[model samples]
Every structure is written in structure tokens, then in C-alpha cells.
Target: MLAPSQAHILVIDDTPEAIRPLLLALRGRHWRVSVATDARQGQQRAQLLAPDLILLDVRMPGMDGFALCRLLQASPRTRDIPVLFLTSAGAADERLEGLSQGGVDYIMKTCEPAELLARVQIHLQLARRRAAAVDDTPAPPLSPDEVVLRAAMRLIGQQLAELPPLEAIAARVGTHDKKLSAIFRRHLGMTVFAWVREERLRRGRELLADPLLSMQEIAGSVGFRSACNFTTAFRERMGVTPSQYRKGLQDGAAGKGTPAG
Candidate 1:
């Protein structure tokens, strides 16, 4: 792992006994480590702290870790935080679920303290590099396939309501999926799917400015499967519910019409 001089980490586990060895291992390592005893608190802390990495236990009371990880992925505020599963569940399906839910690594709690800390440090370092590259200022230069890129953007925007696959977008852009993915990543600093999601959320924000539109209509208009899904996605991306965003717009409009009172 990279130098741990200034990195911050969060551990979400139900068992206090399980956390002891980790705290011991991380002691004197100069990391800002915080713990949450359950998923709900873990989520709140994640949004507020924006820690670089999270060590989440798979099994917990109330919401389990898989669901919690999905919640993290849905929220734009904490979406990028790398989650390493501090779990004892060893089934292949369980591991698959963890990774699918956006966990970066899965480590059993029965392991030695050194192994635990080592995995934690490695993931934290990887996440640091990723955020650094993705958020780089003065983004990388565009490629010469300007025409194709324009075509692709137009296709995505036009079909956002349907939310077609990247392959479809590539096909419509007169290219293959691999090349399209490369171009998107090279020009946009993100994968094609990620950029599509970002664009959808951005467009959703614009649509939220219209008070006439219902949440279901807006969700459908932006290619979300349902209103509930849209709410989660919007909350994740904007750090607020869609209704709240619309209300803020209404509030701002009212403030503007107050006639300087």
C-alpha cells in the first residue's frame, strides 16, 4: 500500500470483538480509522466523512452488507468509496455477491491481523490512485475521432429515456464496442456506462427543475426502471432525494419572487 500518512478509513462491522484485532493492527500506522457498529450508521458516516476506503462486514443486523454496499454505490456522495468486505462467508455465490455489490476485496475475519491490515492498505492505495486519475484537472486531450464521438454523444442523449446498452451505442456510432469503450474512457475519463449514468443523472437534475413533472414521469423520462430506482439513483448522485431537489428549486424560485422583502 502507499504511504499511510494522511489516509482515512472506515470499518463497518456488527461485532465489537471482530474490530479489536483490526484496531490493534492499524495502531501506530498513522491512519485515521473510524468504526460504525451497523449499516445505517455506516452509511451516514460514509456520506459525512467521505473516507477513502471502507471495511464492511457482510452479515449484520437490519440491512446486510451486500445491500449496504449497493446503497453506497447508488449514492453519488459515497459511490466511489472502495468497500473491502471484512467477512467470514466463503461461498462462491457469497463472494460473487460481495464483488457484484461493489466490494473491492473480501477478507475473512479469522485471518491474522497482518493479513487484514495488508489487504486494507492495498485497497486504500488503489482507490487513491483511481480518484486521483479520474479527477485529474485539465483532463486528457481528445482523440481525432471527433465525428464518431459526437455521434456517440448524440445517440446516448437521444436514447437516454430508453437507456440503450453501450454495444448499441457503439453500433449506432459506426464502431465496435471495444473501440467505443476505449474512446469513451480516453476522452471522458470514465467508462461508457459510467458516463451514461452521469449524463442521465445530469439530465434528471435538469428535469427536476420542472415542477409540472411527477417523479415517476421524470424517472421514466430519464430511463430509470421505476420511481423507487430513480429515487435511489438520484439520492446517490445528488446526495438528496428528487423531491427535495425539486423543492429546493421551488424555494429558490419563491425567493427570487419575494420582491426584495
Candidate 2:
């Protein structure tokens, strides 16, 4: 149980100077605040600080807020922390996208300080209440295989655009390729490369579901080197090209109902 004054907040933004007032306002409540300027640093800081709440910027170099949010959700250590998205863009699609990506709130960067602080306070209080409601008993520890899988998946997710070799990935997770292969085979029912292919297609499908994204942008985002390659692979896997699938999605949405993502 933490006191109100003991609550910690992490602010992940590329331009900290732009959000100086928000930082001051947060500290005014006597809460601990930490800042990270980019997605990688933000991830490291979140894991280290285990902050009660996270204020994430929508745009950043390397990885965007959505990607970082997904990474956090995939990790056991930091998944439960509430994330509030701060963006200069107030477009309906952007707000909907943020919420769909598991954000608790999508706040405009230009919002009044008082309103922002009020929202922050609400989430903080809710977090405390949820924590109190959880059982005190500790959950069972993860096995070695589970730990490796999580770490490997996290690494792969972060570097999807330029994934390292299998041996390198295995080494990073403190295991050799053979053991890592066995672990993936046993738990995921596939080889590491096979899983990577499936993950790329999965993420690509997700990007395709968004009507606002272009084919080239979607291709690059999910680690495909070129739109042509993405199309080829997508066609091979889904029995249709990315364009066809997206058209089907839009047509379905227009005719009947919301398409399943």
C-alpha cells in the first residue's frame, strides 16, 4: 500500500521541454516523476521504476507510442500500469486508435493543466483501488522457458524491422539456439523463424485494419522491406493481397458491421 505522496509517474516524451509545465504540475502533487525521451529509454525506465502511472507521447523516433504500449502489454512486469496518451493531434481516428491500443485516456497536449491533472488523479485513484481489491497471495513464479519466451518475444517485438539472427536472439535470452528452438517448439508449436513470420503477418493484418494507413506504411511498419515483398507474403499467408484484404475490410464495415481486427 502506497501513500498518495508516494505515487510514482513516468513521462515518456521525445520533447520534454514542451511538456515542462505538465512535469511541474505532476510534481506539485508530491508524486515522484521520471522522464524518458524516447521509446527504448521509456521502456527501460518503466521496467526500472515500475511507476504507478505512465504518460506516453503518441509520436517518437524509432518506435511510436502504440508500438511501445504493445510491448508493455506483452511484458508481465509493466503490463498493469495505466497509460494515458498525450498527443497534439486530436483527430477522432487518432483518439480511437489510442484507446484501441489500450490507453486509459487520450489527452491533447494543449489541454488545460487543471483538466490534465484531474484526469491523472482519477487514474491514480483507480489504480490504488484496483490494487487493494486484488488478492494478496503471490502468483506462482514463471519457469525458465516462460522467462526466455517473454524476453525473446519482447526483443523481437521491439526490433521487428531489423530482427537479429536466431543465435543472437537466443544468446540475448541466455540460451543457445537449440534450446531456444526446443522451447519455442514446445510452447508455441513452431520454430522461432516460423513464429516471426506469423507475428509479422499478424501485425501487418492489424495495420491493414486501419483504413488510414497506406500499404507502404503498413508494409514498413511490420518489418517488410518493401511493399512488394509484403504483398507477396501476405498473399501467400492470407490467400489474398493486402489491398484485397483491406478492401474487403472497408466494404464489410460499410455494408454490415465493424470488421473484426
lDDT of 1 by residue, 20-134 (tens): 8777777557788899999879977987787878889887877678757766764656767889998888889999878865788888888888898788777777777787678
TM-score for all predictions? 0.51, 0.58
The CA root-mean-square deviation of candidate 1, after full C-alpha superposition on the true structure, stands at 19.3
- lDDT winner: 2
- What is the alpha-carbon lDDT for the whole of candidate 2? 0.83
Model 1 poorest ten-residue lDDT run: 135-144
lDDT of each: 0.78, 0.83
Residues 1-261, candidate 2, lDDT per residue (tens digit)?
Answer: 365568899999999999888888889988899999998799889877779999999778776787677656656667678999987867899888678767899998898888889998889888888889987554444564775687678778767888889987776555678998999999999999999999999999888889899888988888889999999999999999999999998897787765657
Compute the lDDT for candidate 1. 0.78
Q: What TM-score would you give candidate 2 relative to the actual structure?
A: 0.58
Off by over 4 Å in 1: 1-3, 136-261
* lDDT, candidate 2, at 100: 70
* CA displacement after TM-score superposition, residue 230 of candidate 1 (Å): 25
